[model samples]
Target: MIRALLDPSEGEPVQIERAGGRSPVILVCEHASRTIPASLSNLGVKPDTLTSHAAWDIGALATAQKISQLLDAPLVHQRFSRLVYDCNRPPEAPDAIPEMSEIHAIPGNRNLSGEARQQRVAEIYEPFRQALAALVAARTGPSRQPVIVTIHSYTRVYFGAARHRAIGLLHDRDRRLADTMLQQAEEHGITNAMRNYPYGPDDGVTHTLRLHAVQNGLLNVMIEYCSDLIDTEKGQDEWAALTTRLLEAALERFDIHAAGSQQA
Candidate 1:
């Protein structure tokens, strides 16, 4: 969906997309893509940096969009580069709106005054969050909401390094959705699933899951796939079909652990 950002396009670097879904299961991709406006070309980062994890998940947007299509799920995503500001981080954290990320140095973010940070918080961050919170609040109320599934893709390696070969199923204090989804993945013979790979709910991951899931008390999990795994249409469709199967199945059997535990 096209959104409004009060800050000038200079510091304003973010986008959000949404699709309809029957379940309360909302998909969020905080570090979706890295496209710097012409005003600040490349964020002073090299081509390698753009390709690096510092920019965004290499092919996460494609996979996430595909999953959304397969499941007809609403996806709330950040359009700008994470180097500009991380939608997954709280505004208080320096990395919340990073000045430099790994190889890339964001000239726009550097020497940013308080007004500048607040400008981004008000413009890009707040709008994206408000959109998501509104979605959850609407889906849930006196009635039950569907599981909130945050979509993410991580590199097989970090900083030109290789990591363990497994897709991570991430969650924080809330595990019902992750547990159910993990069980379904394993049952399908997907043996390489990582309980929490790359990073967990901790390690400064804020915004998306914390705001849309944990704080809201929605059944939620952050699902990640290896970059190489879903880079191709064949691979993308593979994940889409398999994940949709697991999500549909788990959601069907879901007891709304968040609601029922207290309801009883």
Candidate 2:
């Protein structure tokens, strides 16, 4: 039998926030936590690396929580570090359990028995998928479908170069929501908003969008903020407010109402 990677006492693999919210938006922060199961021993990475962006998307969960509150939306997030098993990545992807993140070699992930890998998938990835899927299903209907929005953060400097983009709106083949937000962001005085900047769908970053939104025929978009912009409570609040406004405007532009509101 495969040993479980996560201790049940530690915590569940997924965390849901505002599950009873009335909004039609379902927010996701796949890299919300940087927690590693004690069994992994920090994946043999340095202490500092555990806190870095490689482990989780810095400031994303806080900003996502604020946005979920502001919009009264439901949020589903992962509770373990992406280094354990990236919830956003497909299981077959090499980086799903990366051996090397940026310049840091993850010694623990270098050689893994198939059973060990499956344990991470069973303990972490599967739970997140189920929770998110259930949340989406609960909100979707023939006349109304929830909009899926994912929050993430990127480092200011990568590979010795400064990233000047303040925000990025990423999308896969479906750009319905992202296009509207990109245009509205610029009009809202966020001139630095770029489409597919920092990371694009081609970078294998849109698995969640493809798996949940696209397959379900629901509108979706992924928002990326620079780490420095939302690393503080003040910054997280500011961005959450700004993002809420943009999302509201986008929904209005599309003439979309919150799912089940008509019946409510």
Candidate 3:
């Protein structure tokens, strides 16, 4: 039998916020937490490395929470480090459990048996994926289909290259939400928004969009904020407010009610 990957003291693999909200928006922060379950021993990584962007998307959960509060949307987020299993990536993808993230080589994930791999997938990825799927399923029907809005954060500099785009609205084949948001970015005070910059569909970053949203024929977009821009509470709030406005305008274009339905 494969050993348990998470201790009882460690939290569940996924967390759902604002589950009872009435909005048709479903927010997801797959890389929300930097926590590595106690069983992994921090994946043999340095303490600082465990806290870096490799472990989680800095400030993304906070921003998503704010958006959830403002829009009264339900949010589903992963609760473990992505190094254990990137909830955004499917189980078949090798990088779902990356051995190397940027310059840091994950000693714990270097080589794994088949069972070990499946264990992570079952314990970490499935719960997060299922939670989001359930939310989408529950909100999907003839009267309303939930719009998936995934929140992510990217490093300001990667592999010694500087990234200047403050915001990235990413999409796969389905571009409805992204296109509208990009068209409304500047007017919403998001001056540095880019379409699929830093990473795009070809980069395999759209797995979550492809699996949960596109496959369900639901509208979706992956929103990426530069980590430096949202590392603090003030930044998270400001960006959340701006993103809330942008999403509101874009959703209004879709004929979805964008105001006065906010959670009290």
Candidate 4:
């Protein structure tokens, strides 16, 4: 029998915020939590390392939460550390259970048995993806499709180099939504917003977009905020308010509307 990676008392692996929201936009935060199950023993890494960006996107969840509230959009976020199983990555990707993230090596992920990998996927990844799919399907239809937006954050300094971009708008083959958001950011005096800065679709960070948005022929985009900029509640609020405005403007500018009847 395969041992369960997540215990019943550990709480649900997926955190759905505003599940019944009526907005046409669906928000996803794959690296929202840094909680490692007690069974993994912090994945053999130092306790402090679990608090770092390698474990989770520091301010991405808070910012995402603010955006969800501002837009009244349903948000689906993972409750486990990305180090356990990166929901945004395809299972075949080595980094899904990374042995090394930046300069920090993860001892637990090293030389894992096939069953170990499968357990994580079964417990953490599939449920989140399914929930997101169901959420999107319920809101989308033949006449219209809901927009998919993922929120993420990048470190200001990576591999000893400083990154100056404050915001990054990433996309794959389809740039429809990203292009419009970038234009709006620039017009709103937010010049730090760049297309595919820090990381892009080519970096294998677009799995969620590829699986849900691109494959399903829906408009989608990923926004990356500099972790330092939105690290605090005040900062999250400011960025969220700004992002909400830009998002609303983009939707109106593109004449996009909720596909089905709006739900509370």
Order of candidate numbers by TM-score, starting with the best: 3, 2, 4, 1
lDDT per model vs. reference:
0.70, 0.89, 0.90, 0.88
Quote the lDDT for 27 in model 3: 90
Off-target runs (Cα >4 Å) in candidate 1 are 1-18, 255-264
After superposition, the stretches of candidate 2 with alpha carbons farther than 4 Å from their true spots are 258-264
lDDT of 1: 0.70
Best-matching candidate per lDDT: 3
**Cα misplacement distance, residue 11 of candidate 3 (Å):** 2.4
**Which pairs in model 3 have colliding backbones?**
none
Q: TM-scores across all candidates?
A: 0.85, 0.96, 0.97, 0.95
Candidate 1 lDDT, 179-227, residue by residue in tens: 8877878787577887777788667663566677788777777888888
Off by over 4 Å in 3: 259-264
* Pairs of residues at least 3 apart in sequence or in different chains that clash in candidate 2: none
Kindly list the per-residue Cα lDDT of model 4 for residues 9-66, writing each as its tens digit.
9988998898877778899999998999988989999877888899999899999988
- Of 1 and 2, the candidate ahead on TM-score is 2
Give the worst 10-residue stretch by lDDT in candidate 2: 255-264
